[model samples]
Target chain A: MIDTLIWLVALPLASALATQLLPRYATAIVISTAIATSINAAALLYAVATHGVMLYQIGGWTAGLGIALRADGLSALLLMMAAIVLLASSIYASAYFNDNPLRRRFWPLWLLLWCSLNALLLSGDLFNLYVTLELLGLSAVALASLGGKTAALQAALRYLLVGLLGSMLFLAGVTLIYAGYGTLDLATLSRVVAAGPIAWSALALMTVGLLLKTALFPLHFWLPPAHGSAPAPVSAVLSALVVKATFYLVMRLWLDIFSEVVTPQAASIPGVLGAAAVLWGSWQALRAERLKLLAAYSTVAQLGYLFLFFPLLQALPAGAARDAAMGGLVILALTHGLAKSGLFLAIGIIQQRSGHDTIRDLDGTAQRLPATTFAIALSGIALIGLPPSGAFLGKWHLLAAAFSAGQWLWVVVIMIGTLLAAAYTFRVLGHAFGQQPYPRHPVTIAAEEWPALILSAFATIGLGLAGAPVWQLLKVSL
Target chain B: MLTAHWLYGLSGCLIMTFGLRAVLLNDSLLQRIIALNVMGTGVFMILITIAYRGPDAAPDPIPHALVLTGIVVAVSATALALTLIRRLTEEQDND
Candidate 1:
C-alpha cells in the first residue's frame, strides 16, 4: 500500500520529466502515465477500504521528524475522483489538441499538476502541504496561460499573484504552528494543538488564506476570468480539482487537526461566507453572457455549497449525524468534480465546433451534436442536485442536518442556490432545443464526446445509485 | 522581557502588512509583483525569528529548511509572473 502511495506521486513526476525530454512522445507518455496513476489510485482506494488508514514516513524517520504521507478513506476517494477526471480530460485533450503545437507544453505541466495534487492529498506535514500547494499553484498558472491569448495571460497573472499572497499567509500560519507546537507533521500537531491564542490566530490566518484560494464569494473575482479564459482542459481541472485541494486542506484543519481549537463561531464564519457565495455566485452565473463564464461562476456557487457543510458539522456532536454530514460533503465534492469537468469538456467541444462559446448563439446545438448536449444535460442534472445524482443525496443530508441543528438560514440559502442553479443549467440546455438543421448522425467525434458523457453519467447516475458506500468510507478515517 | 524575537517578529508583521497593502492597492503590475516578494520575505523573517533560540544555541533546522524551500518556490513564481507581464506588455504594445 505504501509503495502504491509512493508510485502515485512518482509515476506522474517521472512521466513529466520524460515528456520534457522526449516531447515527440509526450502524448503517449501522458496517456500511459494517466493509466498508471489511475491504476495506482484504484489500488490505493482498495487498500484503504480493506485496511483502513495507511501512513508512510519518508527515509525511515519518525512522524514528528520526517515527512509522512497519510491516506484515509477521504483522500483516497478524492484521489480516485481526480484520477477519473484527469484521465477523461486527458482523452478529451489528446483529441482537442491533435494538431495544436501547444500539446507538448501541456503534457509536462499537466503531469506536474497531477503530481502536486497527489502529493498535497497524501501529505501529512503542514510544511509539505505548503510546498505542494505552491507547486500546484505554479503549474496551474502556467497551464492557464497555455492559450497564449491576452485574456488568458492576464487572468493567469492575476491568479499567480493571488495564489502567492494566499500561500504567504498560509506559510505565516504554518510558522506560527512550528513556533508554538514545535512540529510540522499533522498527526503530531493535531494531538498537540489546543484552544488558545496561537491556535486561534494561526487557524484564522490559514483559513483566510485558504478561503481566498477557494474563491468563496467576495474573493471570487479572479476566478471567473482565470477559469473562463484558460483552455478547456485546464479550466476543467482548475475548477474540479485545484480549488478543491485547498478546500480539502481547510476541511482537514477544521474537522480533523484543529477540531479542538476551532470554536463554533469561527466555523460559522466560512458558513456565512459560503451562504453568500451560494447566492452571489449563482446570481452571477445566471447573468453570465458566455457559456464558459457561466460554468466558471457556477463553480463559485457549487464551491459555496461545500463550505456550507462546515457549520452544520460544527453544530452536530461527534456521532453518526456528523459522520453522515461529512459523507454528504465528500459526495457533493466528488459529484461536482466529475460533473463540472464533464460540462467543461462538452463546452469545449461546442467552442471548438462553433468558434465561440456565447450561450446566446447556441441555437440548435442539440440537433447538431446530440451526444454533447446529452452530456451537458446529465452534468446539468448533477449540478442542480436533482434526483439520482450524488448532489441530491448530498443536499438531502445538508438540509436534514441544517434542520436538525435549527439553522433555517442555511436551508433558505440552499433552496435559493438550488433554484438559481436550476435556472442557469436549464438556460444552457434551453439553447439546445433551437430550430436548425439536424445532423444525420447523433455522435460526432466519439473520442471527445464519450469521455464527457461517461463522466457526467458517473456523477449523475452511477454515484447517485451507489452512494451508500460513501457514508461507509467516511467512517474509515484515521 | 524585551528580546530579539519580539523585535524581529514585530518587524516581520509590519513588513508583511505593508507588502499586503501595496499588493492589494497598487495598480502597477511590477509593483504588485515586488510587493508579493516583499510579503514573502516578511513571512520568511518571522520563520527565522521563530527558529532563533539564543546566540549560543544552535537554531532549529526545520523552519530554516522551510524558509529555503519557500524561497525557491517564491523565486520560480516571480519568474513566471514576470514572464506573463512581459508577454502581456508586448501584446498591448502590438495592439
Candidate 2:
C-alpha cells in the first residue's frame, strides 16, 4: 500500500520530468500525463475508500529521523480534487492551445504543477513542504508570466518577490523549530514541542508568513492582478491549488503541532479577517466589470469562508466540531475547487467567443453559448449556497455549527456572504439573459467550451447526487 | 570553533540585507536575479551554520543536505528566469 502511495506521487513527477526533457511528443506527453494523473486520483479515492489512512516513510527510516508521508481523509480528498481539476484542465489545455506556439511550454509546466501538488500533499515534514512550496511558486510565476504582456510580467514579478520573502520567513521559522527541538517532522514535533517564547516566535513568524502567502485580507495586494489577468487555465490552477497550499499547511500545522498555541482570542483574528475578506471581496466582486476580475475577487471572498471553519472548529464541541467545522471547510474547498476552476474555464471560452470577458461587453454570449450559460447558472447555484450543491451542504453544516456554538456573528457573515454571492452570480446570469447584440468579433472556439461546461455542471449538479457518499467518504476527518 | 557560528551568521545577515535591497530597489531584471542568487547564498550560509551545531553526532546533516538541494534548485530556477527575461526583452523590442 505504501509502495502504491509512492507510485502515486512518483508517476506524475517522472512524467513531468520526461515531458520537460522531451518536447516534441506533445500529444503523447499530454496523454501520458492524463493517464498518470487519473490513475493517481483513482488510487487516492481507493485509499480513502478502503483504508482509513495511508503512510509512507522516506529512505526506510523511522518517523522522527526520516521524512514521513501520511494521508488521512483530508489529504486524500484534496488530492482527488486536485487530480480531477488538473485532468480536466489538461484536457481543456490540449485543445485550447493547439495552434498556439507555447503549447510545448504549457504541457511541461502543467505537468510540473501536477508533480509539485502531489509532492506537497505527500510531504510529511516542514522542510519537504518548503521545497515543494517553492516548486509550486516558481512554476506558478512562470505560468502567470506566460501571457508575455507587461501586465502579466509585472504581476508575476510581484508574485515572485512576495513568494520568495514568504519562503524565507518560513525557512527561518523551520530553522527555529529544528533548533528548539532538534526535529522538524510533524508527528515528532507534535509530541516534543513545549510552550515557550522561542516556539511562540516561530509560530508567529510562520503564521504571518503563511497568511501573507495565502493572501489573507490585508496582505492580498498581489492576488487580484495575478489571478485576474492570467490566462484562464492558469487562473484555474492558481485558484484551485496554489493558494490552498498555504491554507492547507496552516491547517495541518495548527491541528498537528500548534494545538496549544491557538488561544480563543487569537483564533478569532481569522474570523474577523475572514469576515472582512468576505464583505470586502464580495463588495469588490459586485462592482467589478470584467468577468474574470469578479471571479478573482470572489476567490478572495471564498477564502474567507474557508477561514470561518478555523474559528468554528475551535469553538464547537469535539465530536460535532470535527464533522461540521472541519468537514464543512473540506467540502467548501472541494466544491470551490470544482466550481471556481469551471468558472474560469467557462469565462475563458466566453472570452474567446466574444473576444472579451468584460461584463458590459458580454452581450448575447449566453444565447450563443448556451452550454456555457448552463455552466455558469449551475456554478452560480453552488456559489450562492443554494440547495443541491456542495456549497449548500457545507453552508448548512457550518450554519448548524455556528448556531450550535452560539456564534451569531459568524452566522451574520455567512448570511451576508451568501447574499453577496447570489448577487454577483445572478448579476452574470441576469446579464446573460438580457437582450443585447453579440460583439462583432469573428471567433474560433470549438475546443474550449466543453470542459468548462462539464466541470461547472459537475460542481453544481454532482454535489447534490453525490452528497451521501461525500459525507460518508469524509467521515474520516483530519 | 565557537567563533565560526557567529561569523557565518553575521555574514549571512549582511548578504541577506543586500538581497533585500536588490529586491526592493533594482529595476534591472538581471540585477534582481543576481541579488536573488546572493540571497540564496545567505540562506545557504545560515543553513550551514545551523547544521554545524558544535560538531557532535553527525553535525545535524539534514540542513546541509537541504542546502545542497536548495542550491541546485535555485540555479535551475535562475536559468529559467534568465531565459524568460531575455525573451521578454526581445518581445518588448519587437513591439
Candidate 3:
C-alpha cells in the first residue's frame, strides 16, 4: 500500500516519456495519463475514505533515514484537486492545441507538465521536489514560447531568468537545511529543527526565493508579462498550477519546518503582504486594457487571498487555526484552479474567434458564443465569492476567522477584492451579454468552446458536490 | 564561525544592492540579467556559508549540493534568456 505512492509520480512520468516516443499519437498519451491518474486518484480517495492518512517510505526505508511521504488530510485534499484539474486541462488541451500548426510538438511538453505537476504535488523529499520544480519550470517556459510571437519569447525569457534565480535560492536553502539537520525528509526536518540564528537565516533565504517564484506582490514584476503573453492553455497552467507549486512548497515548509518560528513577528509580514497584494493587484487588474493581462493581474489578487491564512492562523488557537487557515487555502486553491482555468479557456475561445482579447474592442459578442458567455458568468460567480461556489466557502471561513482574530485590515481587503472581482467579471460578462454588430469581421467558435464550458460547470457545480467531504477533510486535529 | 557567516552575508547583501541598482539604472536587459545572475551567485555563497560549521568541523554538504544544482539551473537560464533576447532584437530590427 505504501509503495503505491510512487504511482502518483511514476504513471504521468511514464506517459510523458511515451509521448516523446510516439509523438504523433499525442491524444493517446493525454488519454492514458488522464485515465491512469484518474484511477490512482480514485484509489487514493478510497484509501483516505476507509483509513485516515497514508504514508509511503521511499525504498522501504524508515522515516528519519531515507524519506517518508505521507498523505494527511491536507495532502489528500490537494491531490484530489490536482487529479481533477489535470484531467480537465488535458481534455481542453487536446482541443486547444489540435489546430495550432506551431504547437504540433506541444503534446509531449504538456504531458511533461502534467507529469511534473503530479510529481511535484506528491514527492516526499526536498531533492525530488527540486527535480520536479525544474521540470515544471522548463516545460512552462517552452510552452510560454510556443506562441512564436516576439512578446511571447520575451515573456518566456524573463520567466526563464527568474525561474533560474528562484531555483538557485531554493537549492541554497535546501542545502542549508540539509547541513543543519542532516536529513531532507520534511517530517524529520520538523522534529530536528532547533531554534538558532542559522535556522532562522535559512528560513529567510528560503522564503525570499519562494516569494519571488510565487510572484507574491513586489516580487511579481515578472508574472503579468509571462502570463499575459502566453497562449491560453499555457497561461492557464502557469497562472493556475505552477504558481501554486512554489507556494505549496512554502506552505509545506512553513507548516512542517518552521511551524515553531511562526511567531507573532513573522505573522504580520505575510499578512501585510497579502493585504497589500489584494488592494494593489485589484487596482492593477482594473487598470489593465487587455483582457488577458487583466486576467493575469487578477491572479495576483486571487493569490493574496491564500496568503491571508498566515496571519489568521497565528491569531487563533492551534486546532482551530489549522481548521480555518488550511481549509480556506485548500478550498481556495481548488476553486480558483477550476474557475481560473475555465476563465482562461473561455478567453482563449473568444480570442481565437474575435482574433483579439482587447477589452475595449468587444462591443457585442453574446449571441454566437452563448456557451462561452455562460462559462464566463459561471467562472465569474465562482471568482467573486458568490454562494454555492468554493471561493465563497473559502472566503466565508476566512472572513469568519478574520473576525474571530479581529484582523479588521484583512476583512476590509477581502471585501475590496470581492468588489473588484465583481466589477471586472461583469465588464467581461457584460460584453458577452450584448450583441456584436457585424462591422469589421465575423468570429468563429471552434470545437474548443465546450471544454471551457465544462470546466466552468465543474468549478461551479463541483463545489456543491465537494462541500461535505471538504468539511470533514478540514477536521485536522493537531 | 560567526565571523565567516558574516563575511558571506555581507557579500550577499552587496550583490543584492548592486542588483537593485542595476535593475533600476541599466536600460540594457542583458545587463540586468548579468546583475541577476551575480546576485544569485552571491545568494548561493551565503547558503554555502550558512552550512559552514567551523574551519575544522565537517562542512555542511547540503549547501554544496544546492550550489551544484543552482549553478546548472542558472546556466540553463542564462543560455535561454540570451536566445530570447537575440530573437527579440531580431524581431524589433525586422519591424
Best by DockQ: 1
For each of the candidates, give the backbone clash count. Answer: 0, 0, 2
DockQ of each: 0.86, 0.36, 0.44
Please give the RMSD to the true structure for each candidate, in Å.
Answer: 1.0, 3.3, 3.7
TM-score of each: 0.99, 0.91, 0.89
TM-score of 3: 0.89
Q: Give a tens-digit lDDT track for model 3, residues B32-80.
A: 7897688667767766777788888998675676678767766776777
Interface RMSD of 1: 0.8
lDDT of each: 0.92, 0.79, 0.76
lDDT of 1 by residue, B1-95 (tens): 23998999999999998999999999999999999999989999999998888898898888888889989988898898999999999987887
Candidate 3 lDDT, A41-63, residue by residue in tens = 76776676667777787778886
Candidate 3, residue A251: lDDT: 82
TM-score (chain A) of candidate 1? 0.99
Candidate 2 runs further than 4 Å off: A436-447, A470-478, B1-45, B55-58, B78-95
Number of the top TM-score candidate = 1
Off by over 4 Å in 1: none
Instruction: Output the better candidate (2/3) by DockQ.
Output: 3
lDDT of 2 by residue, A126-198 (tens): 8888888888888888888885686777678778767776776677678678767888787778777887886
Off by over 4 Å in 3: A61-68, A436-447, A475-478, B1-27, B31-68
Supply the DockQ value of model 1.
0.86
